[model samples]
Target: MSFLGLIGCDNGRNIRSICKNNPEICADLHKDSWCLAEKTKIIQNRYAVKDSEVTTGKQLYIQLTDLEDYSRCIELASGVQHIIHTERTADRARAFRLSTENLSVLQEQTRERQDPFMSYYQWTRFGDTDALNRFLELENTGEVSDPFLLAQAATYYSNRNAIKAQQLYLKVFAEIPFDDFDVNWLLGLASTYRQTQQFDKTYMLTKANLLLTQQKYSEQKMLALLGGNKLLAAELDLKAQTLIDSLEDASYPLSLVKIWLESQAVAADIKPETLPVHSDEK
Candidate 1:
């Protein structure tokens, strides 16, 4: 066999096909009867490394997260006794056992890794302050650009440093639009406005969330934040729709909404106002 002949060979990267061709990749995992989504993601991550001679730091991070998810899902799956074939339960139990050890080993290996995303993982998962410091340093240099990571950073700062949290979350909105956005952040942003007594903005952010997710976020209390000023709340509702429109079309960074969010931080110390003042919150 000529060594040159190996260069033209191609292997499918599909998770199911990869699992079918490489038994050991998924041998320790539970069968399709349980945790299918989690197992698929884990197998996909694993398959990405099959041909690479060395996995990158990002790969290790993703593997760690995937294993954590699979372990958690399978742990729950293992407890649900099968009504028909109890062997299914046994399979999940074995997978849970293996996954627990695998996650622990990976966590230990990356506990001190200094990369930004991995540092975030360590800080959030293990409460490692040293890792958190590294992550914050990277964040300060604007290295943490991923929307999801920025959201996590914003949430971490929300309780400790209000100003930093506001800035980080502003970056999140700058980079992301309404499509597929996490609505929980809206509640956080809304509360921030309530603290500053910018009731109109609080209503805008909250209403935007309700528009997207229709989640039950206690509208009555939100009205109370506005001092029962339904007239003001009703006017701000249109602003909320405008914010959603901008976010929906990915025009938020240049839209008035972005300007408003930035402008409000400067005016945070201004007197409390419940009337329809269109400054910003999130």
Candidate 2:
């Protein structure tokens, strides 16, 4: 059967429904072969594909972001060499609108300036694991000088790749410093250090972060970090024992560590109320 004939014969109703709901799909069929391929998948998968072609920079921008396939999105983005600098002001405006709209479609109503990093940032924030991983590769290779990007990359890698995440966090901390930096990144870096068995660094960073911000710290996680540090534990073992002793009921990690320390009670020589509670302690 012919293409249009086959639509009516078997999948015609499905195609009709998609085309009716998304006129852009119909519009792109004549202009963009890639758009047609994506639209065909929507038909075959019974998922909705966006309308529009890739004739102008604006259309290309929409097409890039509209696709769920990360590789295709990157391919489409690469096809448009300089989308922000399109000769037509309307094209440039449309590109900016599409990119920023993806960031926050409802709240960011104001037409903001074209951000070169917006697409990458959006991919990093909202994309699936594969997309995030791909974006991480791009982030590693690119000259990502922006502190926000570095922090975001670090956060994304915080669980997946502790070494890379710690390195990125250290870079962010060193460049921006705590007094002017995002507290979340500091805590994240501390957590990364904790995960990688860098107890001293974790304690130092966590203590510094507590001093900088009044945000709640997880007592269990902190105690676990301190408990693993032989140097700190040797000097402050009595202090930790005293803190738990003062508390009527302690939580898991703290309780667990306290129990273990109690088993070593003779060796610990625990002191009473010796641990210094900080202003930030919960």
Candidate 3:
């Protein structure tokens, strides 16, 4: 079967790049567009059902029924790797389900094929941290990959073991390049800095996070002022004032400005009148 025929390829640039990079897997390109379109339709239908059920559906059982259908559609998509390879060859769809079915199946098969002796050794060494460390060292020196150990290291650092967590989170960020890193792990780094009274690092991280999320007016202004960026605090405070004035509801707008001004005083020792008010602020 042509790779495109088996899975459909006309998805988007990422998939196209993947197909181009792995020519061996996506060797056949005939009828690729049709398959991609069909898959796309299936996925869209599934999501439509899911969205409808989430918003308007009343029957709990019926909502669950829709969810099950959505899950099955996802599983079907994941099982067809040829389709995935095909989808990579074109710029068609932005969203598609990446299924875990194949991974689960492969894991089960590997477990079935594993040597009992090695399994026994692992079982016996399970709770022995030192022995596990020795095994991990051996794996590091050898060919085996140790994702679980890496995850454990991240957990350890997240649990107040700052040094270990920083190292592991950095390593994982390098390998994974995911948004979740910024959300959870990097936030942990900021927390660690705060705990250690590393005010500079904490301020830097908090400022970076606010900028990254495009949060123009936030408590970061107070942090920035405390960290000696008076100009930035004034600018942000002015922007906040403008945003508050732009709100249609006068009551909420005034309340928001008062709340922010009060928060600034309490958090950064800056009084309300000292803040830079926009020209429109009466």
Per-residue CA lDDT of model 2 for 1-282, tens digit only, reads: 233453554454656666677565443232222344444544433232232232332333334444344234434543554556544334333434443444354223212312324435345444545445555666777656666667878897898898888778656644553344675664687567556565544555555555455556555455555554456645454443342233323242244433432231222322222122334555
What TM-score would every model get versus the actual structure?
0.78, 0.39, 0.36
Point out where model 1 deviates above 4 Å.
1-14, 52-58, 81-87, 177-180, 216-220, 265-282
All candidates' lDDT scores?
0.75, 0.48, 0.40
Candidate 3 or 1, higher TM-score: 1
Point to the candidate with the largest TM-score. Answer: 1
Tens-place lDDT digits, model 1, residues 1-282: 221232233322354566778888999898855777788778766866777897766788789889988998999989999989988888889999999998888888877678888988888888889989998899889888878788888888777776677777888888875665787887677666666566567677878877777555555566665666777778778878888888778988889877876676422333433422222332
Best by lDDT: 1
State candidate 2's TM-score.
0.39
Q: Best to worst by TM-score, what's the order?
A: 1, 2, 3
User: On lDDT, who's better, 2 or 3?
Assistant: 2
